[model samples]
Target: MSHNAASEPDHHPVSTAENWWVFRGPADLPPPPSWRGIAGPAGTPVAQEYLLSPEDVAVVNTALHLRRPLLVTGRPGTGKSSLAHAVAKDLGLGEVLRWPVNSRSTLEDALCRYDAVGRLREVSLERERRSPRGASGRLRYRSRGRHSDIGDFLRLGPLGTALAARDRPRVLLIDELDKADIDLPNDLLVVLEEAQFEIPELARLPEDQQNVEVLVTGSRERVPVSRGTVTCDNFPVVVMTSNGERDFPPAFLRRCVRLDLQDPGEEKLRDIVRLHLGDDALAEAEDLVQDFLQRAATQTLATDQLLAAVHLRITGADLSRDQLINTVMRRLDEAFPA
Candidate 1:
């Protein structure tokens, strides 16, 4: 029943009956045929066969083993978010819990929400329907479920799921920490330190059943959660991404292990293209990628722009380098404005 790198087939048909909610047996979720080619120490890949480096592998492995948050800073299209998926896949961790941060995001957004207002409205309507008749045939006020507490509808959020999952370590992707407000990161300090967060609605439940555990992610918005700062005690594996838009506060930098991602070399890009496409397509696309990379080096384009060109070359009607270069340059202008 165990999956090994060599024995598994490259492609297997998933059952039509199988769905995300319906649990698949172990036999159903076999390893990919080329698993061995991608695996490195600690179950992650040494390189993504193209983009990663020895330093990148080392940093990722250390974070995975030590269970510390690994902060990754890079320009856009440097593959920050993809690293989370690669780690999860390597470790046999199921799916990643992605918490995309933006302005106006709050701790409550990360934690569970108590539908206090909704519950009150529901109770009010129920009470009005059941009230006894008063003078002039008007109904007198009598409460039905008004006494009911709002805590019943409180549900756990991403952070709650991570803390509670003791069986297997979950991969939490906090993408674009810079986009969030200042208070968001500060609010996360408590949960990261304790490895447990509280849902006020849980007070309605017995003390034992009220708390939810989960992993958390923050964007660079620098939300202030509390006056006093907190640090992780459990050493939960945290992955934070930055697009290098702004400089972070000194105090915040002190809390994390930071790594900067460099652009993938030509050989690595070739490997990646081959892995995703085939050898024939890779040969045709390599020169175009090199040109794209040259532009990227000059700060004239982004990695995504390069990827788009490769994708178009592989799938487009004409696989010529000229066609690809023209397509990519056009996309670059649309994606990145002057």
Candidate 2:
């Protein structure tokens, strides 16, 4: 599962090129300048150069061809979330639309959000301006604006905007789906299948005025929606990750192409350490990697743990190597040991 073998560069099929083109950004709108800085705080494009096993590459390609959401199940810190970022960067899909899942998450939260309180305040202020009595005397009430444009109160959430984007398919990351409510995954079935969602506030508008422009993720500008409904020309490359916290409904699973990420082997771990730390740290990193392998035998040992410990050592942390291992190389399950 080397990078070259996994990427399958030699097999230049027409479908592969077409799939690659689907992720290219629109010609009219250049990607925001902020992306250069935001994508990689440390000079790397977020997820662009991330290593993928052969199985992962095959599964991703399949998902791209079928236009289905890719559901990734793996241990925590196995780069599940990073995979979304990597795909977006490699494909030139601008910024990733990330919707983090939690116990209270709902399908509505991922679609669009309405600011009722802000709308009400606008109404109240408009009413006050139109009142008969003023400090001086009664005068003709002049309307500045129509209460407030409904678009002002509506903002598309990550998923909604991704679907609405008229350009290339956006990369949407539904992080940690296992942490969400049981009903959340099941609720996503229609949205995932139909590739669209409706906003009630916009739908209620007159037919003549239903094309409202609203803010969404990615661009600083807003996009127009017809009749308050958002439909995608190209379905988003959705990546939903799970840490094995719970089971998803079978119906939901059937719609998605699933992949399980394998834990990195010692050589892969060495490569990762070399990527983050420098070549100078390899000799020391090898020793620490061995210590981490031992901890992994009994419990979860994320790649980040090894990176952190090595970083501290290389930076001349005042502690001994043994002390650093003891403090930073502990098992991930130590806090909640059974």
Candidate 3:
């Protein structure tokens, strides 16, 4: 379905069938909404509830319906990264494939990593080995495996692995997209549009020899490839996050469904506190929550600060410790200095 910025969510899961999509690894499915655990971070054993506002739910559902990457922008620690984890958990999509962006991150780095030195070393060792001589000057040698196979030296990165996963539509978190260089967003346009990528090493081989079986980042088994091309049978649910650090190119923005997360209110804060801690801790942190709300009015604060403070209090740490609470409550805007 075609989607515009104003598109509404359908409010349905990606697929209805429980096992509609399967993966090789252990699945991290959250408890039903009626149960205790609706959402939190992924891979947690206990079920904890994470309440999503209707607007939040709409944006997520809209992204799913549109099949476009969700570009999430917000202040630091506003659950931007956690959104991807929540989607994966709720949808039974298995572990999230995360590519944390930095100032030096490149598009190729996220697609695949080739160990050329390792491959060269293996080739050198193979050439140096001599066959043992049998009786009557006959040489006995074991057959070498496909020593020239480029797949041996190639491992798909998280983004590429998510694209290559055939069983299910994996959740790919391109966290902190603004941390990347200016060219990064434009560079992603092609891959995002094509839903496939070519490996130069594999692509350079003769057409007949281009087919190889390769291992991906998150899978135990190898997948078949042709001409070193990795195509997506099920396009991954991509969630790209930014801290409102930089302006993206118009073309890049045009391709994504954007959402700007707002600061959490007292009720949501209480829910988040309860999710991490328990009912008793939630009650104890009420005063702290009010203080947080008052401070958040003029300064930037992350949800994690509240969580940290509550955790410390529950663990019997002295809240009166000098600079302890201050350290936890430090604002990102202050640290980065605009």
Which consecutive 10 residues in model 1 have the weakest lDDT in total? 219-228
Report residue 250 deviation for candidate 1 (angstroms).
2.9
TM-score of every candidate relative to the true structure:
0.67, 0.82, 0.79
Q: Kindly list the per-residue Cα lDDT of model 1 for residues 1-338, writing each as its tens digit.
A: 11111221232233332231224332334333232345534354432323467777887877777666777887776778877777776676666667788887777776655567887887776656676874458867675444443333444456555554555667777888888787566567656766755444444455454333212332111211111122222334578898876677766766667778877667666665556545666676677777876766665455555655655554432335676677655433345546
Candidates 2 and 3, the one with greater TM-score:
2
RMSD of each: 10.7, 11.4, 10.9
Counting only residues 3 or more apart in sequence or on different chains, how many pairs clash (N, Cα, C under 3 Å) in candidate 3?
0
Residue 145 in model 3: lDDT: 61
lDDT for 126 in candidate 2 is 75
Error of 1 at 151 (Å): 5.7
- Candidate 1 lands at a TM-score of 0.67
**Residues 37-116, model 3: lDDT tens digits:** 33444444332234567777798889899999999998887778878877887788977889999998989989988999
Model 1's alpha-carbon lDDT is: 0.58
- Global lDDT of model 3: 0.75
